[model samples]
Target chain A: MVVNGAAIEFKKVRKTYGNFVALESFSMNVAAGEFMTLLGPSGSGKTTALNSLAGFTDITSGDILIDGVSIARVPTEKRNIGMVFQNYSLFPHRNVLGNVAFPLEMRGVGRAEIRKRSLKALEIVRLGGLAERMPHELSGGQKQRVAFARAIVFEPRVLLMDEPLGALDLKLREAMQLEIKQYQQQIGCTVIYVTHDQGEALTLSDRLAVMDKGLIRQLGTPQDLYDRPNSRFVAEFIGLNNIIKISGSKHDGAIVDGLGVIRFPSEIQPSQGYLSVRPEHIRRTPTGGHPAIVRQAVFLGDAVRYVVETRNGAELTLAEPRSGENSSLDPGSEIAISFEENRLIHLPE
Target chain B: MKNRPTTLLLLLPAALLVGLLFVLPILGVLSLSVYGDSGFTLGPIRELVGSRVSLVVLERTFWQALTVSVICVVLGYPAAFFMSGLSTKLRAYLVYLILLPFWISILVRTYTWIIILGREGIINRTLAAFGFSPVQILYTDLAVRIAMVQILLPIVVLTCLASMLDIDKGLVKTARSLGATPTQAFVKVFLPLSLSGAATGGIICFILCLGFYVTPALLGGRRSILISNLIDIQVHQSLNWGFAAALATALLIITLACLALFRLLTRGRTEFSSLGVGR
Candidate 1:
């Protein structure tokens, strides 16, 4: 299918409610057909960004452009944007067919055409057999599917989802995450999805923007964010990582306070910054590594997680996969943990 | 099932009050309609059917009530919609304003209408000052209707407002996002959801208008006399207790029938069905 998706750009968009800044100088460019997720906790302005793009709330300054044309003055109806709310927002009085056909009806499409397209959209969402069922009769997952069908039925260029799967259970949420990605790919529409769920964002987004305090802290692919997070917030927010403080740095090595000098790869600049290492990247050895006392060892079914305190008093978490040779260690056992110099990411101060 | 007796015991006081004060009096009136001095007779029914004045008064009462109710709904619905959109603090103040006249005695309100709509009332004086004729508005159907609408307006507005407020605001936003203009969103989504409330308010106003006594008696002319005024004439001037009891029974039956019809129409309404947020 040839998807006529439009590229969207936010140019220094700032929004404020009185003195409370919901978005401050926010700017991002989403390529056509790219699924970009704005992931953040509540009060981080991700929803505000989505709402502003959808024309629900006007920005205090700057502009939003779709396909290189400014739509700052356009109203929500004329924006030609599809939106699925977290609560589903299906019309209760309308059955599945009527709800999906509403946008086409509003556009003054013929009754026959509306029915055809509505059923087709329902089929896209895998809810084709439920056209006669009212919104109240449907389960939570069905309601959200109907909402998704209604949003895409009109062939909107940009699909904005505001935590659409937040109400579903974990298993259903995971299932819908893959479904949403597949649907976005099939439609070829630029999708701006907002959610606080890190796993969902990573799973569904082609590129994800991590937002904090009305600012985009980091924007990149999921692997880039995971392997090389730019800041302490992104490193901690994405996955389990141990951030070791570096007391000093030289051209070839960094001096950790508790541990001795640690060598870095030549490409990595030895600066006065923290070193971040993933829990799974740390290796447990018998000797010839940094000595640490195991503080806690948790027996997860697939992996054993160890919280070890180094001789310098800094705490580190290491995850060891369950294997035949590597046995689970107790809390008071002395262990030597080695870090892969290449895997160690240098974060600026 | 085990708590049924306790439930019945708790409801006993209300049931006894209704049986004594309401049901017994209505039953007495119904019995009085059939019984004569000697024995049971259909004389009151025959008289009610035969009297041209009573027929004319009954017809007038129905039409006037219907018209007054339509006026109240048309005027009250928009007022209620406007109030629903206000901030909570402002809406509370507006609610107090709408209910201010309700707190006053109906007699006092009717008297105030007479003062405002009389020949030398505020409206005519203002018209005369603007170089217009001083229209005779008092003791007319128009006078009665004006007074009735003003008195019954607050109830209609409040009911409509209550229903409008119950609608989830997300539905409107969703409609708008689905390419509906503001007006379209309201007509297609908000208006349909709020119609049940408006219907309830209109039915109440219509029922209240059917039983109106003081407003019509005080503000209407001889030609504009409603069924209640005719019932009064039967009891006092004609000294016909049977005919008066029959009229009372008819009014009671009509009000109950209207309530039943309203119930039937609104039964199983899914006005709030779409409001399930699933959270």
Candidate 2:
């Protein structure tokens, strides 16, 4: 079943358990065929949001619309959404073929059709020959593929994955992340994935929703989130950085602050906002910017990261290429460090 | 091989106990059935096949045991399923109620059935108070069947329950999510999964029923006499030890056969993990 261009809309959805609000008036729009990951830590309501879409959970209030149709009362079976769990909840009693065929069997598909469809699904996962084997006989990666195959066997409108690759090792997780993303793109199914890992979200999702404390903190493309981070949380979370909270003002087209006045962009509005600078963005300058004492310089294979304590006592991290590095300043040596103004994101008030 | 001594030490006591209490008696009975009185004789073996009285008792005993086992399974399956549906705390208490009779002596349990089914018992008295005639209950074949089923019901229910509880709850939820109705999910998943346990329990009940003596003797009349009763009659009243041993041997052989058949029927099911024990 093809999902038309209708977006998934959550209209003032709220979920509560007694006095604890799991999701407070959560609302978002997921465009058709878009891959979005709800990235958050535990108990951040990312999983709750995914569960609400899968119909495994009922919201305490409000309606969820899929393809412009209200599905608040629709049961999970009729929701036409595939779900892959974190632990890969495959039926232990059934073989791989039987597990993949479960969806077809539930829909009362005929015997020949069930076999044909299950084989096709297993073939897609490259597990066609292993269809006779039970789940316990397979490795973590193989079991996860079987889970994906099962989720996609019936061609649902959307796919919901609750950290499907969370159980795999680093190498396998990376491979499966690419594989799952390929399947989603190939089938053009809307994917609502939930994971706390920023790397996974950045690698797989077309658009990412950074969630914290039961709310969507930011929803944008990975480049938008990484390049133009709108909050200290998004900046510090999406990448490694030195976040300096300093009072500053716009004067003569430059941001004048506690460290020193540096040339910022002309159109940049200087206000009481946190400035986030990436470690790689900072460069060693000659006698111009903030004067800093080099505290530590650790070589990390391809690059060297420096920890500097500015004259104002604020610490800044700078990364440079390991080869032909100009800075020979030791721990006690003092130098000047400057950063680009465009990389600094203004935090919300 | 290094830990053989420790293993042997741990198993030696059990081995000796079974050897003395179980294997030794079976060997003795087999020898007595073959070697018989005066000398090794085939008279008892011949008599076991030729005697009309032995044949009739054997037939009645087999049918009664089979009937009682079937009744136990038919009633126990739904009871156990109902129990599994209850909350954990309530199920524990209900299980205790089923097992209360297990703690009592078999003789006491058998006699309690007698009182309940007696003409002057509460049931018949209630019927009489309603101006109805008292139904004959005690010392009948039906009385024997009821007593056997009651005594063996707990084993069936507990066995079935163990199997049912072993099923993963997620499978049911997954089934429901895959568009299966509640009845379909249970029939296709839970029922098949629990059948192995029910079969094991039923076999055990049948085997135990085949060897019943005290309950049937206390509750049933002449028509309800089973193979064990015939063995008892030959050994005590008829003074025929060889014939009695043969009858015992037949019962033992039939029980083993039933167990083997049960195992064969359920071999392909992964849930029947303990079928090796039946062999």
Candidate 3:
């Protein structure tokens, strides 16, 4: 079955429980067939936002639209959405085929057609041979596969997943991430994925919204957020980042605590907040620049990570790609390092 | 797991206590019913089968137990469902409320039923004030059933509630998201999962009802006597110890038969006991 994804809109949604606010003026627009992810730590309203879209939780005041029609008052079952939970909540009493065929049965479809479509969905998840296995008889990964087939069996235009891979081990989780991306592409459903794992968000999302404290801190393509995070929270949350405090304001140069004053490029003003830099952007040299002593060095198969202390006592981490020409550095060895000017991201507090 | 004998040894004390206090008395009663002057005779059994009053009382007891069990399950299941949906704190208090009446002695509670249903009792007096004739409610089959159901409702409700609590609430949410209406979700998912637990509660209520003597003796008429009451009559009024032992042994067999039947139906299926009910 081919399902053209629906466009979802959350307009000024705010949800509160007595005194605690779970979501505040939350809003976003998801394009049809786009894989959107909500990435945040626990208690960051990422789950509340997903629950609001699924109609599992009532919004205090707002409108949720699917395909440009209001669904604020629509009941959950009438919304015709599919969801996969963290534990893969397949009915413990139902077999794999019975679970996958549940949506069709709920819709009063013909028996033969339900069986045919259910088997087809299982084949998509590559579990056609285990259709008759009860849920408890299957392994964890097999249960996850059944959950995926059950969610997409009816060709729902919209699909929601709440940390669907949180229960799997690390290696299996990475494998399922690739399979999930493929399934979403094949079904062409507008997917809303919620997770706290930044790596999983980066790997599977076409576009993502980084949320914190009941608000969306940043929303853009994965590359956009990774390259240019607008706030301190997003910059620190996305990947390994080095944020140095800017002590004083100066257009040409800024006083940074521990590290002495540093000069900025022409037309770039200094902000009295912090300068965000990636570990790879800092390079080590044999001479010149700031003199530093390597405090620690570890090889990570593809790269060598160095944590060095500057002459002014500022600690900075650097990642150098491993190659034949550059030898690994040892701890307590004297070295020189410099930050790339173009790669520096300055944020005003 | 490495010391199997030691683990088994831990069960010896409780097993011995149960054997001494429970199994020995049951053995004594069984032997008395069969071991006649001729040694291992079936004379008591023959007499029991031949007696007309014993057959009629046994049938009445079976039907009464069946009706009461069905009523308890039908009525108590919904109450348990409503309780399961409540907040944990409120549900805890409500569970206490349901069990509060149970702490009082069964005889005391049964006597209260007499005051509520007697000829000059609260119900008949209320009917008389409304210009209706006072109805005879005490010393009748209805009076006995009403009191029996009242005394047994809590057990059924509690058993049903325990299994309901074991269910993951996420399954219901998943069902609704998969396009099942709330009612459909309950019928197709929740009901089947909890059916075994409810059946377990029904069997327990039936077993307890079969051996009941207090409520029937106090509230029932001559036509409403059960198996236990017949054994009471055989011992007290007729002064027949051997015949009473025969009656008691027959009741024991029927109760054990119901239990064995339940075990047979649920032999390979461990979900009911696995939920930690009846523990």
> Which tens-of-lDDT digit does each residue in B58-146 have in candidate 1?
88888998999999999999999999999999999999888888778999989998889999999999999999998988999999999
Window of ten residues with lowest summed lDDT in model 3 chain B? B270-279
DockQ of every candidate structure: 0.45, 0.26, 0.40
What are the per-residue Cα lDDT tens digits for candidate 2 across B162-249? 9989888767766666666778778766787788889888888988988899987889988778888888888899998888988888
Worst 10 residues of 3 chain A by lDDT: A262-271
Q: Cα deviation of B82 in candidate 3 (Å)? A: 1.3
Q: Candidate 1 lDDT, tens digit per residue, A290-343?
A: 899999999998999999999988799999889775668878999898998789
RMSD over all Cα atoms, model 2: 4.3
Every prediction's TM-score for the first chain?
A: 0.95, 0.92, 0.97
Which has the higher DockQ value, candidate number 2 or candidate number 3?
3
Interface RMSD of each candidate, angstroms, one decimal: 6.4, 7.2, 7.9
Model 1 chain A: which ten-residue window has the lowest total lDDT? A264-273
What tens-digit string does per-residue lDDT give for candidate 3 at B1-279? 967999989989999999999999989888888887678878888899999999999999999899999999999999999999999999999999999998999999999998999998999999989999998888988898899999999999999999999999999999999999999899878987787779888998998999889999999989889999888887889977678889889988888898998889877553332122111
Clashing pairs in 1: A258-A312
* Ordering by TM-score: 3, 1, 2
List the candidates ranked by DockQ, beginning with the highest: 1, 3, 2
- Leading candidate by DockQ: 1
